[model samples]
Target chain A: MKRFSLNQATTRHWPLPDLVAGCAEAGVTGAGLWREDVQAYGVERAAALIRDAGMTVTSLCRGGFFQQSGWEEENRRAIDEAATLGAPALVLVSGGLPAGSRDIDAARAHVGEAIGRLVPYALDAGVQLAVEPLHPMFASDRCVVASLRQALDLAAPYPAETVGVVVDTYHLWWDDGVWDQIARAGRERRIACFQVADWVTPLPAGVLLGRGLPGTGCVELRRFREAVDAAGYTGPIEVEVFAEEVWARPGADVLREALAGYRSHVAELPAPVEEDDRAP
Target chain B: MKRFSLNQATTRHWPLPDLVAGCAEAGVTGAGLWREDVQAYGVERAAALIRDAGMTVTSLCRGGFFQQSGWEEENRRAIDEAATLGAPALVLVSGGLPAGSRDIDAARAHVGEAIGRLVPYALDAGVQLAVEPLHPMFASDRCVVASLRQALDLAAPYPAETVGVVVDTYHLWWDDGVWDQIARAGRERRIACFQVADWVTPLPAGVLLGRGLPGTGCVELRRFREAVDAAGYTGPIEVEVFAEEVWARPGADVLREALAGYRSHVAELPAPVEEDDRAP
Candidate 1:
């Protein structure tokens, strides 16, 4: 419970004030928010609401879309927004290939350069730019970074504090190589955010908003949690599910289920080894 | 045009007889087949039909489903059918996790052992078992083998003639490591089959039927064709798309479009280096 955070996306339609009050009442100490939701409620007001409720902002939903025009100004604004909201990380969903373009290698190189250009602004704002690798299904239209290795490589040239990677299970569980990449991210101190969601089948049209709540699908959620822990990540675990069915339900109901799933699947961290066990 | 083969799934609604006649009329000398369709039309009868039309069966659609209860018997039948139809290769779509199973590592290891078990049957039948690594999107429910590297690793222990891999553009296009893996496959002589399909977005529900014709989506079709060719795969280049929209159209119309797309995107193989030019 101490490490559990309900990402606002899990209850996307929940009013900002209600979400803050609900999180406080439910004893949740952290909340991951979206830029649109914050801007709609006024970023300062949203920040004040969370602060008054004595909850911390775990992360801001997004900052990247480097393929679009004016991405520089847009991302700078996002960094400012993250700083104003006291969020430590801004997630970046690197946009897909430019229109009518099939040059993926070039697009990936552009993402790396885009992040490099944003590093100074991110540093100044004290917000880590968390490069998220979306699922490969989105490689053509949503994101060019489809593996944790690519995200880490893109962040390698910048300081760990200024540029890092987001470990989101929904987009990464299908990858067999992710476990090693998670360990590498931790070794480099580049795992800035860890988000949890399950991989569900019969994905909806467009393949977005098809994520399952923690235990509703086939992902080895607890195994992923343990892997990240073993990799030295002790950060807040945000439950960031996006599904139409889940959103249609009451926010409180969804939050409660997310908490229950976390408790069942992610709460039992492995016990620490005794000093004697490590002795030769 | 001589290298083009139409996989039946691309024109799924066409009757087996009509498809055979259509291919013969269109000067398509090669065809890839599905087990169910062949069985429905009587494997012997279908083989006779193709043989009578002076057409060759390039490969069989599938054999592996190692997680199922009767996979050994099922795959044995598939091998026999492929041999009867004169297909040198039997493509295998390794099944996903058994119902409710979470141990993907164990599932993958089981696939290796299962293939080892079937190697004798495959070799005796004179059919190469071609392991296909499907897109990662199908990792959980369709196929656990999700990358060309993994497919090659699984095939490494077996004789190249008895065990090989399928290089499908739709499946391998997003992988950055595929070019090197293709070269490795060529060096190892494990490239049993080469397939082409484009990757259209806004993927329909279930995602199994969202593949596009060669030039209809963002895949670098020409690059994939050249990569496989460089890997020493000089076999039939089968266009194996699976889209509801394509299926809804007339088979002849779809075939013409497939041929046109192949010509525009995949037909221009790199010119062979001349002996005189190489003799500096």
Candidate 2:
């Protein structure tokens, strides 16, 4: 499908050029990239490679971490990088409670203010600062924005075009209120990016790299795809997985499996719809 | 303090007699017991030990896992055990999705039904079925009830005395709405058991353990204690940490630290209060 995207984190070991070539060879046209990976490969060169392959950079992995020092200058550069790559959305994983500071409410309030500071710059740069609410387990150390409601609340102060919320199934699959939040996000026009990852058990050490490839775990993948589709988000559906096991495999093999899993698990519709002729 | 409680899971390896002796020697009056440890030590004997030591079993560690095949029988026994121990609340960790089942809504609805079915028996047994919402990280394999709001909702439609909810700081600290929910639980008289545990970083594998004692992590424990207090809950404050590091130390040492942590991090009120002549 034209909307399918391979988030670079899914194939974390894959070289940028090789990933681009592999996607190109496989007729894939969209990608979700990480800041660190793109920077390592030289932003301009990576942009060129993807451009030459006629692929769209659906989103850039991050831009928030407001808790850290020098966040302003760093986020500005991230916005610049996203602009160069032609990515419309810069996903923001709002960093957790500032070191040793136990006040989560204060940390979260700071994130709102921090985002307000960046809204003007983001609007001018023509990039949507996509606030991604990570899984709650990361609330203490990695990301404080742990629910779709929080993300929407954070984005409410800014214009919908300038700021939006990401709907990553991995982070939100367990939430009973998430379905309603997704609908609310749709009503608010805040859904910027939709990512898919299955939740598997026996979470390894660090609790970071234990995600399952689509269809491999107990997540309702197709339901999420359908919900996002119904939410007026007709953009790229990025299959982003972060697991040591998935990364240990050959990049090409992992890519193939990712594509295959997306096809069998996420791409199918509940009932066949009339084919659209919008694509030229 | 009159409200302090030591949850047995904090010192998992501590023998029943030694733990009871340790608590008695330390002048602790309340405890939260685990089903396995009680069964392993002989329930009647354990009950007699705690009863003779002049300590109260504040609450029982569990009684939910509705997804399992023998759950009804298992839970009935758990209720009986709580009755035997004279514990007022039987905390339920609503089981995760059924095998190969991706529909979480169905699983959660089943939990509601399961709790409803047990309401009459719980009432007859003079034990409150306290529905505990585990952290979202355990939503897949351990517990699907992931928020205080959800737990309260499930406990709704039943009598407040028969069904209530557990408010554990570790499971609910990440939720911004929890403060309001804690207030709500107070309004509805659903605050059956109030628990305290700090959320530390780099969670161990399986994540069943890895909780920190109060003041060790970023959670605002005193704030939670104050919230519950404001919510009109004057119940036992159970210190329930389940980390390997905490368990490795001698039970007496851990108990002292837990008591000390609770004293410094949880018991000390922000404002001085009039002494209660209510305690005879």
Candidate 3:
């Protein structure tokens, strides 16, 4: 049976403790948490609450914003938080193009430099830095890692295990190179996590929060599952929606809906049948 | 000096005659026109008016809806219109993913097949087909040719003189693969037209109408010009904004702004430094 995890950010209206308690009641296997919540609750207390409720922490919310004043210090702090929280992956939203800079290549190079400085600390802390390539709409004000190929290239300079990428369908579905990039990432052993969400209509300015829950939009979820599975990634398929409407709903209701949507759309995906299995 | 061409869609609010008059007043050397306007003006009259005003028709607005219900007949008619207008290139907005279909690959194949069938007709009519890959945001409703690479691939099986691509900065700017794809298209002799517009903020559901006029947004226009020039594309850099607000402005104002922006941006670009120029 496939297990499910709900990113706590989806229930952002609720506090960490309440969100975790709701997840526990809903019988979710795990939760991906944001560092802001962890800091608010204190990392030690947050981890304790998760353990007390018997929930696995699949991932820490994020660490990368490596294009600002004091990015080195910020990244170090993020890695420290990831370590303290006992999370396997520290998701990195690579900072967007620096203000007033029209040079995307320069911004990308800045990201590479920042990540290079942070990789060793993250690896030492047993935290994998998962670079999340944002959609191109965010190319100016958000992450410069806009494609898996670009993310993989940035990760190439680091050890694959320590530096990886977050495969979020929302940011990447429009890209033609996605499948090829996924294949290349898999071949190079660079996939850190597989995140799923649907791309919905009426995209507004603040493009980050417009994602739909699974089964609510046009993505071919089954096909996406098949491609990732084919690429040798059998990790937790985390549900990470940022819908304002969904977040506005009660955390418990959101969790219930996410689970139901996940089960209906993802868990039922047909497994690839091998010839040997058929014979058996 | 590089010449400036006004893509009439930049002043979509204006009728054909008024747009031509505006462009001529603004000292634009050429105009990129759409089929609907041509139909409205009556094809022969539109061509005659453009000739009378002494404006070059750089490329016809569009021809491809090859993924929809009326693909064949529509494409044939588009060829006729392109021929009637004596358009240097008949821009093809390869239609989007069809209604009730998740098969983008099938739609793409259909586009390839449609182009294959239409190429000979286009050649016979002396109208070059320029495949225009719209921004990926329109992948579901407007165009499946979402990247220059994909457009180049679609054009590969056809002769460049018969079928090629339109490299519009608005569509191709977000693509990290763009520079390389443009270079390759140049090598293959497949760049049919070069268009310009800027990517901007605050994308609404009607974002199709929110495009920025040249030099009004974050795109590195001079850099784009350098790349186009480096690819041996010395054709007029056609300004093709689709902003509703810009269109709502008087047609004369739109043309004046577009030309001024184009001149300032293009003046900084290095002239052609390469030999392998794309065809058609």
Candidate 4:
């Protein structure tokens, strides 16, 4: 059976314990927890609660804002937190163009160097660093990784077992090469996670947190799923709807709606025609 | 000694002839005239006015909406209008995702096939089709051509003299591979037109018109110019600010501000570096 995971941000209104319990009630086998939620409740406590609730922690929300000058220590500590939470993956949104740095290449390099240093720690902690490419609108003030190819390239030298890429529809719906990239990532064994969110409104900050639920927009979710499934990825299909309006509603209602949307929209994707066809 | 090209949309408050005369009076040597402006004044009258004023038509606003089922005739006619205006290039914004068609790949193929049919006509008419990649925010509702690399790849198999890409900063400000792509376009001799506008507020369909003047926001205009020059591009830098707010101001004032900002910002860029240097 296909598995569903609710990213905690979808229900930021609910406490982590409640969210986990809610996911269990909704029959979702997994959950993607946010760093702030874990931090607020304490990582160890949140981990205990989630485990007791018997839910899969698909991925930890994030840990990568290394564009600033003195961020190495901060990043290392984040690695520790990810390990403590027992997350299978630690999603990293490389910080935006650094403050006062016109050289985006430099900012990107700073992120690369930071990732290089943090990888060993992540490997030690049994946490995979999943690089998440944000929408291009966030290039200036949020993240510099803006495409799957770039993300895959950044993770190239790193061990695939320790570093992978997260495929989120909202951020990647526009890329011409996204389909091919998904197939390549699958063949390379680097798809760490798959996420769903619709791109409807364009925010200045880019992360409007008002992402539409799947099928509410034009993203070919079914085609996208087929591409990932073809790539031999059988991971939790995490629904991380960042809609501010949607979150304003009751968490239980939102979960119910998300589940319905996921089934009607994402679940119908035809599995790829061939399996193990990625043979060299 | 850099030249300023007033995009008619910049002085949308003023009529076309008045804007042309204004450009002449202000020592702005070039202008990007829009289709509506040309159509209202009649192409013959508009062309004569531009020629008599001794001003160059940098480019005609656009000529491509190749997503629909039967758009070839309409597209061909737009190409004809571009040719009649004596504009050196016709900026082609590949239209939005077709309704009910979730297949972006198919949509892209349709765009390519449409362009393929139109290329010979463009070449014969002495006009290059300039493909402009809009910001990803408009990926669904506007242009599907959202990356310079994607645009370049689309234009690659075509003749550089027949087809090229428009480097518009406002639409592409947030792109990660910008400098590299700009440099590549320059090397390929496909950098047909240069445009500038700053991304300020969030993009609502209506507020997307709120682009900033050249020096207004955080865009590294100087760095961009350096990158373009380094790639051996010596084309006129057209100030194409699409600010609804600026248009609400007096037309003359917007032109004056754009002129002053362009001179100040363009002056700070480094002298042309190696056109092929990958590193800044």
Name the TM-score of candidate 4: 0.89
Q: What is the C-alpha RMSD of each candidate to the true structure, in Å?
A: 4.1, 3.6, 5.1, 6.0
What TM-score goes with each of the models?
Answer: 0.96, 0.96, 0.92, 0.89
lDDT by residue (tens digit), candidate 1, B207-233: 999999989899999988888888788
User: Model 4 RMSD to the real structure?
Assistant: 6.0
Candidate 3 yields a Cα-based lDDT of: 0.82
TM-score (chain B) of candidate 3: 0.93
Q: What DockQ does every candidate get? A: 0.75, 0.85, 0.38, 0.35
lDDT value for model 4: 0.81
lDDT of 4 by residue, A167-279 (tens): 99889988878999999999889999999887664443334665888777788776777789999999888888886788799888888988887887888545676756765
Error of 2 at A16 (Å): 0.7
> lDDT-based ranking, best first?
2, 1, 3, 4
Error of 4 at B72 (Å): 3.4
What TM-score does chain A of model 2 get?
A: 0.96
Question: Between prediction 2 and prediction 4, which has the larger DockQ?
Answer: 2
lDDT tens digits, residue span B52-139, model 2: 9999999997999999999998999999999999999999999998988988899999999999989989999999999999999999
| lDDT string, candidate 1, A1-280, tens digits | 9889999999999998888888888999899999999999999998999998999999998988899999999999999999999999999999999999999999999999999899998998899999999999999998999999999999999999999999999889878899999999999999999999998888888889899998888889998998899999999999999999999999999999999999887778557999999999
Q: DockQ (C-alpha) of model 2?
A: 0.85
The C-alpha lDDT values of all candidates are 0.93, 0.93, 0.82, 0.81
- Please, what are the lDDT tens digits per residue for candidate 2 over residues A1-280? 7899999999999999999999998889999999999999999999999999999999999999999999999999999999999999999999999988998888999999999999999889999999999999999888999999999999998899999999999999999888899999999999999999999998987899999999999999999988887888889999899999899998899989988889989996546555684445
